[model samples]
Each structure stands twice: as C-alpha cells, then as structure tokens.
Target: MKWNSSHKAAGQHVHQPGDKHAHAAGDGHNHTHGGIFGKNTELIFSLICGGLIGIGFGLSFIDGIPPLVSMIFYITAYFFGGYFTAKEAAQTIARGGFEIDFLMFVAAIGAAILGSWVEGALLLFLFSLGHALEHFAMEKARKSIAALTELAPKTALRKDGNGTNEVPIEALRKGDVIVVRPNTKIAADGVVVKGSSSVNQAPITGESIPVDKEPAPEGSFKIEETGKLDDKYRVFAGTINGNDLLEIQVSKEASDSTLSRLVQLVNEAQTQKSPTQQFTDRFERFFVPAVLILVVLLCFAFLVVDETFSTSFYRAMSVLVAASPCALAISTPSAVLSGVARAARAGVLIKGGRPLEDLGSLTAIAFDKTGTLTEGKPKLTKIMPLKTDVTEVQLLKIVVAVETLSDHPIAKAIVRDGKEKLGGEDLPAAHDMEAVLGKGIKAALGNDAIFAGNLALFESLDESKPSAEIVAVVRKAEQEGHTTMLIRRNQEYIGMIAVMDTPRAEAKGALEALQREGIRKMIMLTGDNQAVAEAIAAQTGITEARGGLLPEQKVEAVTQLAQQEGKVAMVGDGVNDAPAMARSTVGIAMGAAGSDVALETADIALMGDKLSLLPFAIGLSRHAKKIIQQNLIVSLGMVAILIPLTILGIATIGPAVVAHEGSTLIVVFNALRLLAYQGK
Candidate 1:
C-alpha cells in the first residue's frame, strides 16, 4: 500500500463517528468486553507484547539465532501490539475522522520503513500498554459507581398468607408486605410492621453505626415499646438488616427506591462535564489535528535541512510521538470519575462535574434555619398557667383538648407531653373547633367558649384583659427566643406555653469546619422572628441570622449575599430551600433520602439528615480540585519538554514514546487516588 498517497488524499483523523471512546482526553476508547484474558485483556495483552519484544531484543545480542528468525520475533510482537490500534485507526480513517491512535499507527509504520524495526515495535508496545492500563484503571473507577446496583438483592421474600415466595424486586408493589431476615438487604423502602432489629445504613446514608429498627405506630405486631429511636419505623432498600426478623410494608415501588434513584443520578452525572474538562476538550479538538499538520510540515522542513529523507522522516516521527497529548486528554476525566465514584460510596451525591467543581469554589453559604442548623422538631419547653385557681397540670388538660384535635407541629408537641403527664386518663374533646389565621384556635368545651391561642385572641376584649404581671411574663419569654402561645377561656387569661426548636448537637462543629475550609461567611434565614433566629445562630457558628423572612424574603437574602460574596451556596432542608437555593451559586439539599424535591433540585445532596456531611462534601471537593490541577501541570509539562527535545534530535523515537506513555500512566493512577480520600 502507498501509505503516503492515501495520507495525502485523506488529510484528516480516522475514527468512526459513533465510536464510544472511554479514556480521558479521548485516548482511552471504549469500556468494551475484556480482550483475550477475563476482565484483564488490555493489561494481559500488553504483558505478552512486552515479553515478545524482550525476546526479540535479546535475540539480536545472541549469535546462534539467524537475523531472519530475529526479524520474525519482532514482527510477531508488532502484530500483537498494533492489532487493536490498527483496527481503531482504520475505522477512524474510513469514517473521515482522525484520532491520537491513528497518529500512533502512522508513527509506527514510519519507524518500520526506516529499518528501525525494534524501535517501532517498542513504540507500539509502550503506546498500547498505556492505553490498556488506562482502560483498566478507569474501569475500576466506573465499576465503583456501577456497584450501587449490586447493593440490593435481585429478589425479595414476599409474605403470602400461608408462606413466603421469592419474587423479583421489579414485581414488588407499594403496600406489599415483605419479610426481611437477618444479615440481608432490605428489598424496598417501607415501614416495619413486625419484629425489631438493628440495621446498618452505610450504603444509603454513609452512617457506619447500626440504627435500631422498631415497629410502626399503628403496626399490630406485639412487642414492648422502648420509647423513641431515630428512623425506628423506617427501613430503606439497600441497607443491611441485623439479627432478628422484620416484616415491612413497602411504601414505594422498586423503581422509586432510594438506591435506584441514587444509581440513576450518578450514572447521569458521569456525562456532565466540568469547566476544566470542557476547556481541555476544546483544546484537544484543535490540538490533535494541528500536531498532525505540524509533523507533516516538519518532515519536509527537516528533509531540506538534512542530507537524507530517512533521517528527516525519523526525526518527524519522533516529534509526532512526543507531541501526542496522551496525558493531557485523560487528566480531568480520570480524576472526575474517581472522585464521583468515591463520593457516591460515601453517600454524598454530587450531581455532576459542574457542581463538584463549584462546591470547591464557594466563598459564602446561606442556610435555611428550620431542619438545617436546628432539629426541625419543636419541643414544649415551658408551661405557665395565669389563673390563680388553675394549676399547671389542670391548665395543660384544657390546652390538650383543643390541641389533640389539631395536627400542627406545636399542637403535636403539646399533646405528646400532656398525654405522657396525665397517665392513661381520658380528656374531654373540643367541639366546634375552628382555627384562627396566624393567631390561634377557638373551640366549644361543652358550650363554655374556650379560646386557646396567642395574645391576639384576647385583643378584642378590654373587659377580659389579662393582669399586668401575666403579660409581662409572656413578653419576657419572647425575648429569650421562645415561641409563645397564650390560652384564654371565656374572656379570662388562662396561661401561656413556650416551644423552641433546639440547635442540632453537631451543627456548631459543622459550621466551624466550613469556616476552617475557607468559607468566609455563613448566614441563617427563617420565618421565626429575629430573636429566635439569633438565639439558634449563637448556639451554632453562623456569621449572620435573618428572621421573620417569608419564602420570597429568604430568596432576597441569598441574592444579597451572592452579590456581596462571590459564589454563595445555599444549604437548605430540601423543599422550602428551593427558592433561596435558586438564588445562590449552588443549591445543596440535605436529607435527600426522604425528599424527592431535594434529589431532583439540588446540585448536591447530603443523603442523610446530617449537618456533618456538609463539611465533608466541601473538603472532598477541594481535594479533587487540587488533584486535577496537579495532573494538568504534570501532563502539559511533559509534552512541552519532550516535543522540543525530539524535534531537536536530542531525544530519539524510543525515548519519546517512553516518556509520553509514562506520563499518561502517571496521571491516570493519580486520579484513582481519590478513592482513598476521607473527609473528617
């Protein structure tokens, strides 16, 4: 074949349009079926090629072996090393496209024509080895992401009336009861209806400790209740159930399981590019083709300067091998793939490359106060009865009557305490109950008009106004950050109750960690009044607190922060945080396992309802960012030095190929290091 005639006619890269190239910088192509060996084809074939090359090189130094036989050994090694590269290069050329592998094939053929058979064989062998090792390393990272599918068992034990049948997870429907035995994964997200046990939730929440699982509130299973435990009644798919038995009533179909959605998002995230990667892609688009043209121009330029065409061609080939952007192309994708896989395993879902890099660049953060810095549950902190005749317990009973019929958070808190205090005692229910907007409620307690609400409920009655002493106490409670509600019965001031949402135990430490990580500011926003917001802010390490803010006001506060500080991130409890989160540079949703809105809306999600993971996510992102910069510096630096040296005849074809392929291998291995990263 007249290779030069065809090369002149083509003048472009040779690659099929739809070919799935898997490696970074586009040199690593396709995560296809393993080559000759099982799941180790590329590496194994490279080793075999290396063995033949070593034997061929050794035969030249020996006397007995004929030169013809020695040539045969080199030819066999070339066949093994160049087979896939040639196939891909041929396909690329046929499709009217060009690739780095195609350039590599031309360089190898150039070496063969120059009668440097050993040098050419070595070049092909080393080039193939780099691609093979890169393919293997990237597969390891990709498999880490794919491993999410394996966490759940293929089938679940569906409980029938007489016995249990093993059914595929796809067949499981909502409300279907399934029995989970010891040391097995829970097949669906559901509530436990029977039995008790401890379940390890690391796969779903990254929590290493096992949590105790209890029966549901209305579950008919007979077992002694042991007060309250966090997430006691809930069991999610992909978590390991400990010793003892549990029968779960599925809350969602298998397709909607937490693990399924997590896997789906992660797989989609791999396709999303970061800014650095996008820049590299644009650079490679022009760079690869330019290198080919430069090599062709340099070949003729060298021929005019040198005495022989062979010498000029060899130098151009050396420059061609040196100029290949093997390392530059693979750097970002290698690091990104590894980092994403590591994060998913730890239960931090960084949506894609853009958000992963954005997280590392955030300067300030705004937090939604409810269910974020503070435990969302309101507690009945104090109960004070105003009437001289009504004791605290007697007043609680009257309050419980109206509260029991309501499902408001404050009502639930008051009812739980009242029911616990008055042991097994029946109380009269409030009839003709009606709620007052933003103030309180009014009800008929056996025809005696009972009004139990805030101070506004008594504003219309100057004749039934409370004494000065009672009003003073209620006003004092408000300053201390308590949400106060006053009760009145038939124009008489009965009492006042205070409820407060306490700060989470780990909130302060998490905020401090963010400050240490170079986050300049942290703000808390909520609907509570300024005093209550400030109280919680002081308990935590928030830089500023804005309260009495409606949903729209929260968005305004986030926007103001973004203008003042570059790259502001909004951390929210998932649902209400959407508006404010949209205003910030990045939206972070915590407690994703429970919120569909959080998983779909936030750029990043802390799967568990833990504030501690926020600091970890940012720390891990910074580490990944650092690794990416290091890889770029090394890859570009090698190409810069090697290209000039090869063209100047200071380095030959063998050494140039060695250095180029060596740097490519180094960057890939460096990216895989993200798997070992641990955030405190």
Candidate 2:
C-alpha cells in the first residue's frame, strides 16, 4: 500500500495559527479556576457564605441572633451558589424552551423558597459540576475530528527553480514542485519524480508496514507479484515521506486533497440526523408540551379538591422540571461522536454517521473479484509454443517486444515477465505499434509483422493462420484457471502467454468471518470469465459467483441483491467498482490496494486491505446499535414510570428530581459504552 501521510501532515496547518496563544489562554484560565468557580477566591467566598447560612438556620432554632440577620446570611449563600444558574434558567426560558440546566435551576430555587436552603445550594454546586463533566466528556469524544485539523504542518518546503523555500501550506498551488525530506510530512498531493524510500502510511491506509516507493512509473514498480499500480498514478495528501528526499510535483492544492474532502464529508455526516435522532426529536417536541399540560391539570385538580395552592403549585413545578427529556436529546450525538472517533483510531474512515448507521443493518455483501478479492496485478503463469521448432525464448522475445509498446495491464505483465528472460537490454524494437481498445495490439518488429491479443486480435488479421498446438495451449491454460494471450509473427502462430490474478491469502478467512457474522448471502461479481471467477470464488469459500460483468453490470448485481436482502454492502477496489460501491447500501473500499476513485467513492474505507475488518466493522456497528436501542428504552421507560408517579402523588418533588437526574446519567453512561466496543 502507498501510504499518503501528506494529508495528515497538511491537516496540522488548520491549527497552526494562534495555537500557542490559544493554549496559553487555556492554561491561564485553568490556573485561575478551582473546581467550578472561576478562582480560588470564589471557592473561599462560597464556603464562607455556606457557613454563614448554616449559622443563620441554627439561630432560627435558638433565640439570640436576629431573624433579619439570619435571613441576610441565607440570601448570601443562595447568591453564592445558585445565582448564575437562576440567571441562565431565565435566559433559557426567554429563548422559548428549556433544558436540564433550567430544570435544575427551578428545582434549586423552589428548595430555597421552601426553607431547604442547604439542599438548594448543594444541588446548584453538584448540577453545575455535572454539566462541566458532561462538557468535558463531549469534548473528549470530538478529539479525533479536532485532531484531524490539528496535524497539518504550518509550513511547507516549496521547490523554487534550483533551491527550496519554506512557505505556508496555504500558499501552495497545483503544479508547484515541493521537496519532502526524511521524517517530514508531505504537504500536498503529488508524484515522487525523484528519490526512493519506505514511507509509513498508517495514518492513511491503516497498514503498519512502511511502503517502499521509487521514482518509476506506477505499473513498472512492482513491489510484489500481486501488488502494482497502473500508469498515470497520483499519490494523496497527509502521507509521510520517508528517509529519501522527494521532489514531488503537486497535483492538487492542500484544501482540495483527499484528507480535506474526508474531513468535510465527515462534518456533513455528523450534521445529518439518523432515524433514531429524528424519532427522539419528534417525541421531545410533543413530550414537553404534554408534560406542561399535565402540570396544568395537576394545579386544576388541587384547586378543585380544596388543597393548598402553594403545595400544589410547588409539586406541579417539580414535575415539569423533571420531565424535560434533555438527556434523551443528548444520547444519540454522544454515541455517534464516540463511535466515529473510535473508528478513526482503528484506521477505518467512515465518511459519516449515516454510513455507520447503515453498516449496522447490513445483511448481505457483494464483492467485485478482480481488485477486491483477487489481487488485481496479473502475472505470467504459463508459456506455450505453437509452431514446430519454435523456441520459448524466440516467442517470448517477440511477445515482449510487441507488448512493451502497449500500456495495458496484461501487456505490462507479459513484457515484464519476458524482459527477465531476454537478459540484456538489446531486445528487438517494435515500430508502428498500435493498441486496439478491449482487443490487442499491432506492431512491426524487425521485418516481422506481430499481432498479440485475444481471439479478436487474430480475427482482425486478414492472413493469420491458426495452429493445432496453439488451440491446445489455449484450452489447457483456460482449463487450469489462466487467461491466455496469443502471439502471431508474419501471419503465423508463434506462442501464447497465460496470465492469472492470484487470490489474497486472507480471502478465505475473511469470507468465513463474514458468514459467521450472519451474512446470509455472499456473492462474487467480476468482469472475468465464468470459469476464472468461479474457480477463484470456490477457493475463497464464496458459494455464488457471477462473471463477465462490466462496470454497469456490477452495479446491477448490487441493486438486485438489495432487492433480495435487507441491505447490501459492496466491497471493491477498482475505478470500475466505484459505481457499484456508490450504488450499494454500504460502499466499503479496499483502500490499501484500491484506486483513488474507489477510495473517494466508498462510504466506509478499510484502510488496510485486510478483508477481516469488514466482519469486524459490521459486528461493531450491530453492537453499537443494540446499545443505543437499550439506552433509548431505559431512558423512555424511566420517563414513563416517573411522569405517572409524579402525577398520582406517589413521588414527591425531591424524589422526582433525583429520578430524572439519575436516568439522564444512566443513559449518558450507557451511550459512552460504545467507545469501549470491540467485536469478535
């Protein structure tokens, strides 16, 4: 995998300006504050006020202190602890709605008016402290998103003619050359036109291995027999440039890079409300008004029954405060933020909350075989001479000479394999080379007319002769799971090269894991032939396989599967797979070996090509969804039980307040469990 750390490094630029000043300001504020108070002086003042209020209450029981003096001390304690909350509650009410802050404020004021001054002061302090803790928790949950914008470098090494200059990354533009030195972050998306080294791309691809890169064309620099890239390759931002010094020509500016787009999409997704959040919002819209009506009915019933107006009004106010449903409103966001943070930490970049929500309900998964299951890189598997007395070397040299002129994947594989046998660089040069799209190529190699391709290439020849040996070679290669390309010299059959794409080592294990996780239907959709696709699928434990699919055909397969299953996820890693990936219920990109189009189009990206993460991601989402459901049920149940108990006089004001706060705390804690979620 080519790890792009430039994006991660470039993201740090988002925080560079004023970061030191902000940190200094934050530290200064921290030192001045003690507990929830703004300063140590405030804490001392609160203590003094509380002590004086206790003394006043004690004096009321005795007969020496004046009642008015006692009242002054009591007022001081109320002002010290509950004053800010009272002001905030009034502000919230003026905005036409209420929150938990308002409820706690009203309850505290009611306690003070009823001569429970100590309880009211304690409630104010504890509630304020709780709100602070919740604020800290939410900030912690958002750390990953914040970190995304904090890792970019403030300055970039820009290439200026012969020398380099350090400039702000924001000043970078497309086509500008940049120098990325050892251990430095790449500032923009570009090609390494010079130098070679191993890069740590864990931030981008989620793979821990350092990828070795060289200044060669993408398809020519084959790291493994199964790993290579096509021509016209482009590396992305946020990748780390390793030990070698790289002179890269920037393709995209800092803001338009992959990492920047990912951040933008993630933020957009966060703003989109899921079904559960929508339900909660609708319920609260009606729930709050219904609670108000119940409070009115309680007051009317008390007056009709000749009860004291003061006691009835106080009870009704408590019920109204207790039924605000603020906790329920906060539960979904907390869970989603925490879940997204955890996923980013694991290297699976889910674009938004909606994709995460959809992942939980996935019942079926469709895979594109070429680049998704089997490694897309083709290798020369066999060589068969067609005519009598024709040597393998002679045939290979001609095939390589003609193929070297073309840039197709299969052509590259043949040329690469034949180049090894030719030994030196003095191979025959081909002239008049012409490539036929989806067919083959026509070239002249030193007085020999060469035609190399599939059967269509031979059919295009007017005077080409087919041999029995060539037919047998083609038949045997196809039967043994290989794609054969025919080579002709001077209208006579020469030889054939059989190429095959090897399946991934982890393919079988990943397929079984998906099955174990209750993926009822697993299918392979490929552009290859039926024989090749079926052979690969069977080896990888995929029972059902569809072959000979074009890019559009792959999309149709996903759509058909979606009709049969509850939800379908398409996993692929090719430019051809982008449409299907977008069409599926969930589009999972095999980022490690996938094209940029696949990576950008996929909703969920498996940074590492380890397909096992698919099942793990699915299981994790299901577990998170279950926990969310459990939390919602617990919160709503508590509300249902408490509202009736309060109305029927079975629960008093203090107990109702305690129950409401406890339920809120419980739901919030339950939602936090998603952060610790791990799947088998």
Every model's TM-score: 0.59, 0.57
lDDT of 1 by residue, 361-468 (tens): 887998877667877667777889887999988788888898887655567788987788878878887888886634667888876788777666667635687678
| Every candidate's CA RMSD | 13.7, 13.0
What lDDT is obtained when candidate 1 is compared to the true structure? Answer: 0.69
Model 1 stretches astray by more than 4 angstroms: 1-273, 278-282, 307-314, 387-392, 407-409, 417-438, 443-449, 476-482, 489-492, 527-532, 548-556, 579-583
Query: Worst lDDT window (10 residues) for model 2?
Result: 1-10
lDDT for 617 (candidate 2): 79
Instruction: List where candidate 2 sits over 4 angstroms from the true fold.
Output: 1-273, 299-301, 385-398, 417-451, 459-464, 475-483, 488-494, 500-502, 526-536, 547-556, 573-583, 592-602
What are the lDDT scores of the predictions, listed in order? Answer: 0.69, 0.63
Q: What does candidate 2's lDDT look like per residue over 66-125, in tens digits?
A: 777777767777776555455545665676764444555655665666555555655555
Q: Compare the candidates by TM-score and give the number of the best one.
A: 1
